[model samples]
Target chain A: MLDAKGLMVFYENMLALNNVNILCKENQIVGVFGANSAGKSTLMYTLSGIMEDIKKKEEMAGGERITVSGKIQYKGIDITKLRPSERARRGLILCPERRRIFKESSVLENLRIGGYLASPAQANKTLDYVFKLFPALVKLKKRVGGFLSGGEQQMLAIGRALMAQPKLLLLDEPLLGLSPLMQAILIRATKVIRDEQQISILVTEQYARPVLPIVDHAFILENGAAVMEGSRDELLNNPDVRGAYFGV
Target chain B: MEILIYGTINSIALALMALGFALVYGISRIPNFAHGAIYVVAGFITWTFLKVVGLGYFLSALIAILVTGILGALIYRFMLIRVRGMAISEIIASYAIGLAILEGLRWGGFKGMTYTLPVFIAGSVTLGGVPVDIHRLLLIGIGVAVIALLWLFTHYTRIGLALRGMAQDERAALMLGIDSDRMALLATAFGSMLAGLAAIVLLPLGNIVVEAGYNVLILAIAVCIVGGLGSWMGAVLAAFLIGFAQILTVVYLGSHYQMVVALLAIIFTLIMRPSGLFGRQKELEERV
Candidate 1:
């Protein structure tokens, strides 16, 4: 469903993403495993066209000189130069790192805001699906987003993205700062969403063990480079992968 | 009794004047320094349509509001779009636009005390033994109605919800397909119309002079600064505070001190709390 080739992102003199390639087939969950500063978020930003926005903002502020070179194709259409909002309209939604929820809005309002591109019926249906997928949110419908726990916030973030009716959902570090139990729940839900909605997902994580069981294809990123690529079992069987990511 | 009635009316008027500035700032982080120019221009447009063009009052007012909205959209599209994300540039460009518009109108001969709008109703009623004009009473009603309508619009409508989302977090809203540029344009247009509304409602009580533009700008800035830059509720509360203070000054220290009250409120708020009363920026700073 999505293909990105030869993606290179530079921040001044430092390279954030170096000659990397990633793909997500229809109805597939692709895992990107990397440590801190591994270019995972940069990859997500590049794919979702947020890099263009960041580049423009940085340029306007006269801050960093960010350079991004890449070709991104979604559903066989080149979308490298599309704005983030345009990409989102075409169903490329990113649930960004840190669960950037509208802190002042209530959970229900957050979901409503997420339904910006959706029709009334589509929004209502997706909203119902989101609440069903994250049933815990049903109880906290009126609670403000900032007051929610980290786990609840992550759930809300995913639910909010689902409200956008994404064809390809990019989950950037969904497991960060989450409890093991919450991570397990989120991983399981991620798989169920793919099965139920037929939506492709690209999830990035530092630890791959909890997510490995669900991802069909996995890539390991090291220092902005794609070091390894294989199917789930192919990665799980490797001693180095198991030792470094699986903590075995 | 006179003080109470006049204070309430004056407070509502101040709230109306500042609402547009506060809203544009809140949604797009654009200060919209052209707010006062829009107000004066809308009043002039309505007067032109009414007297020179011989149109009816309602039609002229409606046309003026629409024209002002388009003017605002044009300002954003042509001028403000490039300087966006740069705070100083946004302010300077908008203020420059405001200065040009006000000065242009003055040069174009939209001066003197002869330009005055007719009140919607021409009667006075006794309120607590004080004679209050129907227009002032109508202004209060319109002010309350505008606030209520704005609340309902933001809370219930799809576009309004998207706007609120953008106001809270621009990038997150973008991730959900809410176009920030479109929302900002809509905000600028709506805010200009709000300024127009204030002009149409309040100008009937006095003449439409070019100098009123500068006074309106200063007053709007003072109220917005005192109320916390982007909070509507804060603007309303601060308006009442400063409104009452201005009324009391006019009653005791002479009417000339009315403008002084607004300037003093701005200064005091800046000195006491730079963030104003309900500022979220300060909380975010504290968190960091």
Candidate 2:
């Protein structure tokens, strides 16, 4: 239900995202696999409209000139120039890399803050859903966000995004810096969220093995370009993809 | 007994004055240098309503606080929005606004001891052989209530929680659909209303003169700086520290040396700690 075409982003003379096109259908989980500096995070930032804010700040400070050109259609509406908050209001929320949870705030307060735009009934319902999805968070409701472990913080970040009631959740490197077991648990929860809540997910990761099981379609990005796109089986069957990404 | 009674009263007053400045800085990272100007303007507005418009004290005070809040929001929306990210520009612009307001009021003949708000209560009562006015007791009561109410607001309310999130990590808050500009505007408004509230309660003890505006601004800055820039608890504790110190100076040395106490506290804090009593930035720096 989301289509982005001909998306190009440049920081001065350097291209950060080069004519990238990505899509996610309704009730689908899409995976983007890449190495460091592969423009995966850049692509996610471009989609979520945070690039607009960074561009404004850079221009105001007379720093690097950021040029972005794209046509993003979500549910048949073009939202290329929308502000980040406006994009979020349309149910496109980003759970950013590094899990930028509010450190001083308690877990419950972080979730409550995420429900800023939700009605009381909706927030309450989603809060219950989030707690259920991440049972580890139930016991740490009163704990400060900074004190939580990296795995717990990732769960809280995803749960906080869910509190916003996203139709399409953009997860940028959710598995970064987490143990293998934590990655497995998050992958399982991601599939569960898609299955039970009918929310579309676009998740990016450096390693594909843990995340590939849940993704219906996958895209391989290299040097700011999308090199390949296919169903999970198509990607898995490719010997080159197996050697480079899947480690099969 | 006299020193103890007056010191508590003085400390609470300092806390009330610094609370608004601390709040705006804490939430939005805007120093809001116009806080003192807003305090004076609220006093003038209350005076106009009470005397010229013939409104009662409570009604006038309420309306004045509301007007100052809207004034603060408009300032952020129209003026400060242009210079949002630059720290130096924010300070210069807000201080310029404060200068214009304070000087503008002076130019408009709002001078002298003519403007004074009537105390909420009249006369005095003896406490342990030290007589304190009823109005000062009411000030202490209101100050405690304001702090309690503020604590509850930040902990339990929706917008308040969002503000706390914004204060901690603004980009993360924005990603969660909490509008940053809207939250900053709300913070400015709430902070200005707090300054107005402080003025309504504190200005009644003496004439509302233009000089008090500058003095209040300096004192607020001193409290914020000495307490650590954006820490709420730091500001309160610093206020008590400075307030008691000021009272002690007035008692032992001389009343004229009272302002020196606040200035000296600021200098000592900067030299000894640099981050004040509880600066989070210093901790972050140390970690890095």
Which tens-of-lDDT digit does each residue in A187-247 have in candidate 2? 9999999999999999999988899889999999999999999999998888889999977
- Candidate 2: regions farther than 4 A off: B281-288
Question: Which tens-of-lDDT digit does each residue in B133-231 have in candidate 1?
Answer: 999999999999998998888888999999999988999898888989999999999999999999999999999988888888898889899989888
Which portions of model 1 miss their true places by more than 4 Å? B281-288
Q: What TM-score do all the candidates reach, one by one?
A: 0.98, 0.98
Query: What docking grade applies to model 2?
Result: medium
* Highest-scoring model, TM-score: 1
**Compared with the true structure, what per-residue lDDT tens digits does model 1 show for residues A166-234?**
999999999999899999999999999999999999999999988999999999999999999999999
lDDT of each: 0.93, 0.92
Q: Which candidate is the best by lDDT?
A: 1
Candidate 2 second chain TM: 0.97
What TM-score does structure 2 among the candidates reach?
A: 0.98
Report the C-alpha displacement of residue A28, candidate 2, in angstroms. 0.4
